[model samples]
Target: MNRNYLLNDAIISPLGFTTSENLTSIRNSETALKLHRNSRYFKEGYYAGLIDLDWINSKFSRIGNPGKYTKLEKLIILAIKQVIDPSQNFSTRSSGLVLSTTKGNIDLLNNNDFSADRIYLWKMAQVIADFFELKQKPVVVSNACISGALAIKTANDFIESGRFKNAVVAGGDLVSDFVLSGFQSFQAISSKPCRPFSNDREGVSLGEAAAAIFIDQEQSAVGESVHYIDAVTANDANHISGPSRTGEGLYQSISRLFNNSGVDPSKVDYISAHGTATNFNDEMESISFNRAELNYVPVNSFKGYYGHTLGASALLETILTKKCLLNNELLASHNFTESGVSVNLNIIREHKRKELRTALKTASGFGGCNLAMLLQKQSL
Candidate 1:
């Protein structure tokens, strides 16, 4: 099987517009999550990580007409543009595009100017595909919060199967009224910035972000890069909204990946978990990690920094994990002050330097969906 190598990448979020900027902010223990009192989203207000629209328009004007695309489309285009090399001509026939989003242009439903068809997910995918002049039809992944990770897994499968030589995977979501209300109805929105896996942690703080990465079959020769080793997704059919009490699905996903790759669980140096700060999700992850014998691994959640970015969470977190592997640093789990889960975990409470070579990124979403991906630094 052809191995998939991670190439260039980009991130547009409240933290910064580029991947380097985002990583630097994280190294300094900075967070973009804040309290928003906007009545448009919720009458009682909520906490979220949101990008400044004015900044986005100013930056996007240099690339293309901002009026032609929606907010989410602009974010996706800007992210992917940073990954493409203008001097190198890409083969349209051998290239693929995969878009991941739980709600693509869902905010457009309230806008009167756009037609009803503008809200269609497939139509949004077409718009993104046309922007890059990609000849092949794009693949869309929208399986709840696991969409980002699943999209990358889909691209890996494509490259390994010889369906495409390379692929561009992009994901983004906005904290619009539609999204805010849905979570509000579930009483899942936290009153303040989220505190992942902390004793006093509340619920989730919704966030918005756009992230993109280029994956190719060939590895880069210039600097350190990570490659996809194995990935798996499992469903416990536990419930529609709640996770399995015993973490059955997540445990199964991690166990399968390790068993198939023959990689010992101890080899994993760091973990980027889906610690949403909610009682059930965080507790469930603790149970799952203990079951997989990963209790001693250094674990941290990016949600405290970016808030649960829904479809973009997994991909955005993956980019940071790649950076950590190359820089040999371990980022502290922002807002984690005290342990909250039942089983004890090696939670990273402070930023520190370490010799990181392997990482495990996990995500669990609604509909009983769970995903796990193993990544390793390329040996020189």
Candidate 2:
């Protein structure tokens, strides 16, 4: 099987528009989550990570007509554009596009200005595919919060199977009234910025972001290269909204990943967890990590910095993990002060330097779905 190498990437979020900018903000301990008093999202104010519409529109105007696209579409387009090289002649037949999102254009359900067809997930994918002139049909992944990681996994499978030479995987979600109300109804919206793994941690702080990366057999020339070893997904079928109490699904996923890849668990130097900060989710992950004997590894969650970005969480977090490996640094789990879960974990609470090489990026979502992807720094 041909090894998939992660090449160029981009991130458009509340923190910044580019991956470098977002990393700088994280290094400075800056968070995009804020207390929004907007009644449009909820009856009571809630905290979330939201990008400024004006800012994104201004940036999109330089490349394409912002009016022709939805907010999420524009974000994905801008992100994918950054990863694509204008000088390289992309083979339309061999290239693939994978889009990850839980709810694409969900906010447009009641809007009359756009046709109903525009609200379909496939339509959203088509818009992005057309923007890049990708001739092949795009694949869409929407498995709750695990969608982003699963999308990347799908692309990796395609490349490994010799189905495609390369693929562009992009994911994004919006912080809208529809999404906010859903969380609010579950009483999972935090009153303030989230504190992942902290004793005082509340619920999740929703966030919106778009992230994209190019993956192929060839290493990238412009940035630090990383090898996409393998990814595994498991479902415990525990509940509709809650994770497995014993972390069965997550543990299985991690175990399978290491077993198949022939990599020891101890080889994993860092963990970018799907730390939503919700009590059940965080606790389940803690137990899972302990079960997998990853308790001693340094781990951190980007939720405090970007909130739970739903479909974009896994992809966005994975990109940041690549950045951490390249810079040989461990970013502090923002807003984390004390350990909250039952099992002890080496949750990174302070920004520090370390010689990172291998990383395990984990994501668990509703319906007991869990995924773990292994990434290693390529010794260029």
Candidate 3:
């Protein structure tokens, strides 16, 4: 079925409230991350993509039960408001809600007052649906790091399946004691900003953010419009917790997206990579880029600007990638030098100039999940 599918609306995070402001930040390579000294554990002062929650609360004061919500809820609501204001969309009939996260409400466990198993993945869905009072059933996707991209995939499916007239898909996660302690356990925390695919690359900096996208088949012709050309999810069954060192899963995901979308790899102008700056992730991405023969396509990572957002990472990165496609601009990879992988691909070290008609956003998750999305500029 050649169903009607599109990514017409969005509510992004860690950059700015509006598309223009975020795009400007990307062009200037200005980062939203800052070293925080909060006593929430993990006090080595990691760079975080800080959100102005105070501004959000004051701006959307009329939202329901605002005081009862947690920081995660507040972030979700803020992004929700960007797409469907309670004053409008809430009063309507049932709408679809897809919330993605790896570890929902992990901040609650910091005080030793809460437990981990209590955080069932499905609870994330209920929390958001109740907030808007839309009478809609919410779907939650908890695929570790690939959660965000999977949320987008689910939204696209529902829209194409005629399950709802439209949908609100939000991705959110926080950098709390739980995540920081775990990353530190794995020895994945970097003292300074990360450098992806570089010989001097260290581990990733963990951060938190919430982003929402309103995808619908209806063309309003009034709002800012962009398309999610095609997306796919693939798993490396060989490894339960780690990626295929050969980049097999990543390569398969991109190959599938291209084959499904009928888009050529050589035609892809830019790659919004999941360059986490980890030794393994960068190498895998480079291997995949080489196999796909997309080395000429300039590449960059938002991790330098917005740590590894975990569940919300891919969605946030895709929003930035779409911005580049809309503007035909290429961003730098922040800290990078010396090829770690055997590939001739141009790993963009500085903001490069280019015309992007098509761009690909790729992500990999724990539990062997990998995903890719192909996007194209709309011909006006």
Candidate 4:
């Protein structure tokens, strides 16, 4: 196999914690988003996706130094334990760890006045490595929201380069006062959950989660076959924190994937957009689609299903996209009743039944970085 990034396997998310549980949730359109009334900003309350802390908490009463870890990291470490245990696959010979988090310990700092220097990025990576005894120094990617994609891409590189035989990339973040206050201060937190692409759109609701995937270069038959990271990380230096107004970065990234993979853009059946439901993000993404000649690709975002998990946001969405890619079933774009952006786009409404051979993922973040990853179906 001459493939660049082969995603030999993946697990499901949001619902049905296992791969089967998550697939059943999507097939039935059962949403994990709930009405969050206990938040500081929500005097009356708004809907959001929250992992059942108490439930999962009781299960992980044994992780050492759980107090030092942020709520997000705890959740992620627990999730990682579910997939990776020291007894079976934690050997230091071939396995490696890659951790993704935007506010690694920012939440901890906000909750307590800890020294900022103590919040070094390397510490977060070490926590996971020690927890599982993988012994390999983990690579941390914290490029704002694109951290998860970056981590996955980094893991792919490690495996392809023969540095490791199996690299587990885990993405996670928790809803904390630091992020909530920041979004609310910017007037971006929706009073209601959010109405992405709707005529009565407000803004995005903050969400928290931990999603992990095991990417082994060795092919497996049990998990669904969604090729992992076939194409990734085409950078665009367009803006400091927002998407390129003209989508040049997005265009270039998608173009690079197609050109390098020899897969025509026209062959792509659907797209999982960064659809944050914000005005600029939606508008700029539409323009990027047009510029990339992908205006026709049916686009959807799983953000509606799970607020946005900062570091885990892209990872959660990527896993969902992989599920859809394997099942030949696409998710509804959700919350798009009208086109608010400059260009009219194909927003998936009902579940799309298409032969999704290849699905393109487009994501941008603070510091003007754009990423396009083309994931392909398993060969027949």
Candidates in order have lDDT scores of: 0.89, 0.90, 0.74, 0.72
Q: Please provide, for model 2 over 101-178, each residue's C-alpha lDDT reduced to its tens digit, 9 standing for 90 to 100.
A: 999899998896677898999999998999878888999999999999999999999878877788989999998889
Off by over 4 Å in 3: 1-14, 39-44, 52-66, 86-91, 110-118, 222-225
Clashing pairs in 2: none
Best by lDDT: 2
When 2 and 3 are scored with lDDT, the better candidate is: 2
Error of 1 at 148 (Å): 0.6
**Over the stretch 19-107, how does candidate 1's per-residue lDDT look in tens digits?**
99998888888888987888465676778999988889888899888888888989999998888753142466778888899999999
Q: Give the clashing pairs for model 1.
A: none
Clashing pairs in 4: 7-228, 16-21
TM-score of each: 0.97, 0.97, 0.89, 0.88
C-alpha RMSD (angstroms) for model 4: 3.1
lDDT of 4 by residue, 9-38 (tens): 233334645556666776676766678778
| lDDT: worst 10-residue window of model 4 | 4-13
